[model samples]
Target: MLTINNLSVHYGGIHALKGINLEVPQNKIVTLIGANGAGKSSTLKSIMGLAKASGGSIKFNGEDIVNKPTTNMVSKGLVLVPEGRRVFSNLTVEENLFLGAYLRKNKEEITKDLNWVYELFPRLKERVWQKAGTLSGGEQQMLAVGRALMSKPKLLMMDEPSLGLAPLIVKDIFGIIKEIHRNGMTILLIEQNAKAALEVADYGYVLETGSITLEGPGKELMVNDEVQKAYLGEHK
Candidate 1:
């Protein structure tokens, strides 16, 4: 449902992304796995128009959206959860979720999605009135995902959903991602946790120094020698 071709991004003279070509099929989870400075997050940001693309195209469901403003992308059913789970700290969990649907005209649909979010994340429902900043790291991440779901997006781009959490919590988050995918949300996942990400992803891409180095079915990539050596911590 999303296609990025010959994508490149530069910060003044520093090149952050160099010719990243990737695609996420509809209703499937696709992961971009790489180490730090590999331009994984930059690819997601470029899709949301948060990062200015210096070259090439970003297409969402066949529409060119390379340089579309972030809000426009949101309106077009493309939303990013971002790397840090940047929730509104001072807002209550419910308020944060409400803000996510602010652009929608269909109040009933928003209410339905909110109920679904609550059902999917009972913790968020329990802390509905609590300030987002007061939630634990895991809870905050749930809130972030719940808030994004409130947007009712066709494609959800999440950058590092399990960045800094306990192993158990990371598992919980990935489980939720699988649940989200099962519910028919197309996902473009950027993660450093290659093993876990690939386990849940339908397809995977490996990026190095801003370019795609390998692409294949997730299971295939997980067992490949190069991927095992570079990402899976396995010796040849």
Candidate 2:
């Protein structure tokens, strides 16, 4: 449902992204797997208008959204759960979630979405009145995803959801990701954990030094020699 073509981004003469092209089809999870400085996050940021695109087009369901404001993008059903779970530290869990629906006017629908988030994340419900900063890392990440879901996204873009967590927690997070996708949310995932990312995605792309190096079905890329050598820690 989202298409990025010839996308480029520059940070004061430093070329961060170079004419990269990718797509996320409806109801599918598309992942971008890469190492640090590979422009994976920049691609998501540019799509959300957090990073200025120097050239090319970002289209959402056929219309060009390259020049749209971040708020406009969110209102348009394109939402990003950024690399770090940037939750409102001082706000209560409920308050933080409510902020996601700041642009909406329908009280009943907002309440319905809130309950849906709570059902998907029972921990957030238990800590509804607790300050977001007090939650554990896993809880905070759940809160981040829950908050994003409150916005009722058509396409959800998540950057590094598994970062800095215990292995068990990572598994839980990826499980939730799969659950989200199964429930019909289109996802564009950026992850350094290539193996886990590919396992959950329907399609995958490998980005290196600001350009796409490979693209294929997720399972195909998972078993690829180059992918195995570089990202999956396998040696022939």
Return the TM-score for each candidate structure: 0.98, 0.98
lDDT of 1 by residue, 70-179 (tens): 99999999988988899999999999999999899898898999999999899999999999999999999999999999988999989999999899999999999999
The per-residue C-alpha lDDT of model 2 at residue 47 equals 95
lDDT of 2 at 122: 92
Candidate 2 lowest-lDDT run of ten: 227-236
Q: Candidate 1: which pairs clash? A: none
Model 2 ranges with Cα > 4 A deviation = none
* Segments of candidate 1 deviating more than 4 angstroms: none
Model 2: per-residue Cα lDDT over 1-236, one tens digit each: 89999999999989999999999999999999999999999999999999999999999999999967899999999999988899999999999999988888999999999998988899899999999999999999999999999888999999999999889999999999999888989999999999999999999999999999999999999999999999999865
- For candidate 1, what is the lDDT? 0.92
Best by TM-score: 2
